[model samples]
Target: METFLGIDYPTLWFLVVGGLFSGYAILDGFDFGAGAWHLFFKKEESRRIALNAVGPVWDGNEVWLVIGGGALFAGFPVMYASMFSAMYIPFILFLLFIILRAVSIEFRSKEEMLWWRKMWDISYSVSSIMLAFLLGVVLGNVLQGIPLGENFEYQGGPLLEFLNPYAIMVGLTTLALFMTHGAIYLLMKTEGRLFAKLTILVKRGIIFFVVIFGITTIYTLIYIPHLSDTFREDPVMFAVPLATFLCIANVPRLAMKHRYKLAFLFSALSMSFMLMLIAIELYPVLLISTIDPQYSITVYNAASSEKSLGIMLNIVAIGAPLVLAYTVFVYSTFKGKVKMDETSY
Candidate 1:
């Protein structure tokens, strides 16, 4: 049945994932850039200031991932059960890595001890590196499909499936994507040495990731066989990646001239489009299988009752705008450049 917008349940889920991924890219994108630049900010105070730029709102960005988890649990229990069970080891490790990053960010300031701060600093970067890899690998697994049995169980998993070449490529691609997003964040948020450092970082990252990502994407298409077919069959699906990379290329030149608002706008869009590409790639089917086509969880088959979706639609309609408004207000209030003296968590 059609909702108010004439969208069906399957299409509605794509919208929800789109919203969740968009929020993640906008909020977490800055964190990734700023965090990666942590090494470049030689001065302790400047590092703190760089961290402060995202302090008030970084946690809020993670809510999108939480929403993503909730969406999977509520909207597609089949994918939920299969993925969680198959990827339990890496999933648990991801939580630990994320917690370490959060703890280091919050408690680093509380401790004035040099050794303690340094220890936490390493903790932050290390955790970030591992966490980013895990996130990408998950995507890689999705693209490649795990060794699920005829019953949808990922029997050929654990270490073997996790380390497949396709998954490794996906991991690298995500690292590049997140770092690219982070670079743009740095270019827009800081001034003086910190800002310049970020610029260099951005230039290198953008050059590397944009190229690597493009190559990886092509490699994926060639290897996957059915990927281009999926895209040709659904025109909107193919456009997602093409549009995202284009924005990534265009935003920096505009930002260099202090056109930050525009840069931020495009950066947010770039990150969003990357996730949109992933969601669209997986459309109709939340999780497809190498084991069996029957195991694929399509939206219509996995979704909750029509009544449940209707209630969710109404709730999102009421609450989504307020959430968007609050995020915009926070970012705008803290707009312009941050200096070393101005650091807060």
Candidate 2:
């Protein structure tokens, strides 16, 4: 119940950051997921509809990620430094995909050429694939811990350390989640034949996602024993993921009814639950000390000084709503079924 700027700082920070990330995921996850299924459409026209539904909104959605980064740097500088330094290679690749995906989306539409469109489609799919993988890797490294040494520095090591068996497995699971998310998004945002096809794909994806996610959960328990304590301690923590999965599990029924919003909401719930689980596992440790647990960076270790955090609290309160309001305005104005016959692509 600590207060900052005449308001509770910790609560506000968590609420703001959580809301921003959750909002971003709920909105953009589908688009990212939908684009991830780019390879599914052999025909350019069908792909166009899927692309159009997300194109207007995808880049804007990612602004939340940028905002999250800014907040971390400003309010959680130690976590930022440690994470960026340790995960430098993956982060760079992730950015490259983001930039390429954004550029390809715009450039592909300018030309009516089939090859250009196909290239962009591949770029989008490739970028989407990498995006999901990088996300899981980031989460895995954070929760699972990376190589840190004396005084909490990212003691660079062989690339293999980052690509350990568990890390790779987690990457695969994340890719599956994004694929399902993209498929569900397509079902929600588009209509006609494209929507029907997307609906089927998403429905099918649910089963696979469930099995993969289950296996990953078990593996995570065994692979990263340190994380199990958090999950074991709180029975309710498991409910978030279950609730999210239940939404995905029932997406088939919802999709057939053309309940696009609910479908997407469920898809978002699934992803969010998984993310929450990760955060729970990482709880107090913002940056773990690989050399010694004594040198770890918890919220207390990585968070800014009380006074500085107080100042940041005021700044975030002002900035967050403006971003969310604009984002919502853009989406609401753009909402509804996407038609390929229209000026799409």
Candidate 3:
């Protein structure tokens, strides 16, 4: 067993994969959140402003997803295969919605007809909402455990099984969180009436998210006791959830103070903290097997060869910094309110 800084290679790779997805959730999350609010703005100008808020960086934000997926496939091919096999339909729907969202954003303003723009607007909003929800559903199923049979294969079952109550609750919770995040982002990019409208929306979004999040938390505590085991064992681990709550609470506080930049930052931080909690809860186990404990795909069982992981880690060491630099540069270049020119989306 090779070690990097006293952590095993597989565990190190697990952290790497988690970090990439966390980055994706933080970056692309706002994009999805922004899109989720598309239809809320009635006027054409308002809609366009909202669209342009995320236009400059939405596609770039998706780069994290690509990198995260690739890292998962490379680092833990077995887990990737098993999870994908079990969640094929949901993943396909996710792909479809993601494509539709992209297409809607790109093509909405290309035509002059009102019907044309409306069609895309609906597509964009619905797609964004569905994308966020599906991601949560997948996470929920992963957290609960999948039916992985012998040889790490998915036990055959109806696709509708993925839509269990827990998964749906998680999905809605994810949607609410993203919507709140998006509203805060919109506040940063607009002024006057739009800003005023977004202020109200942000408040509503916060309430929506907090309510759903509270319910989801209660449900998890009541139904899925395993998720809290980590914290139960180590009292210190409670700090993560506490910090997450504080970060979430700070969003509305900063927004009320007209400090949207801080609000957005806190929203992103809250998301990161939430994912960190998930990572802590599920460390080492990539996917739990409902069929049998022994069949579960763990980091150790699912990871690639240590040599391969080592070489890839070296490559990631060089590549990740470059990606991060590029991301920072892009966001910095496009900072502040969106001013639409002829080329705007």
Ranking by TM-score: 3, 1, 2
TM-score of each: 0.91, 0.90, 0.98
Error of 3 at 192 (Å): 1.7
Put down candidate 3 lDDT per residue, 99-176, tens digits, no spaces: 999999999989999899999999999999999999999999999998999999999688789999999999999999
Q: For residues 150-209, what per-residue lDDT tens digits would candidate 2 score against the true structure? A: 657888688646776667778877778777777866766777777778767876676667
Clash pairs for candidate 2: 33-182, 34-182
Flag regions of model 2 displaced more than 4 Å.
Answer: 1-15, 234-248, 252-258, 341-343
Q: How close is candidate 3 to the true structure, as a TM-score?
A: 0.98
Better of 1 and 3 by TM-score: 3
Residue 241 in model 2: lDDT = 60
Model 1 regions lying over 4 Å from their true place = 234-241, 255-260, 339-345
Clash pairs for candidate 1: 33-182
State the lDDT at 187 in candidate 2. 66
Model 3: lDDT of residue 277? 96
Per-model lDDT: 0.74, 0.75, 0.92
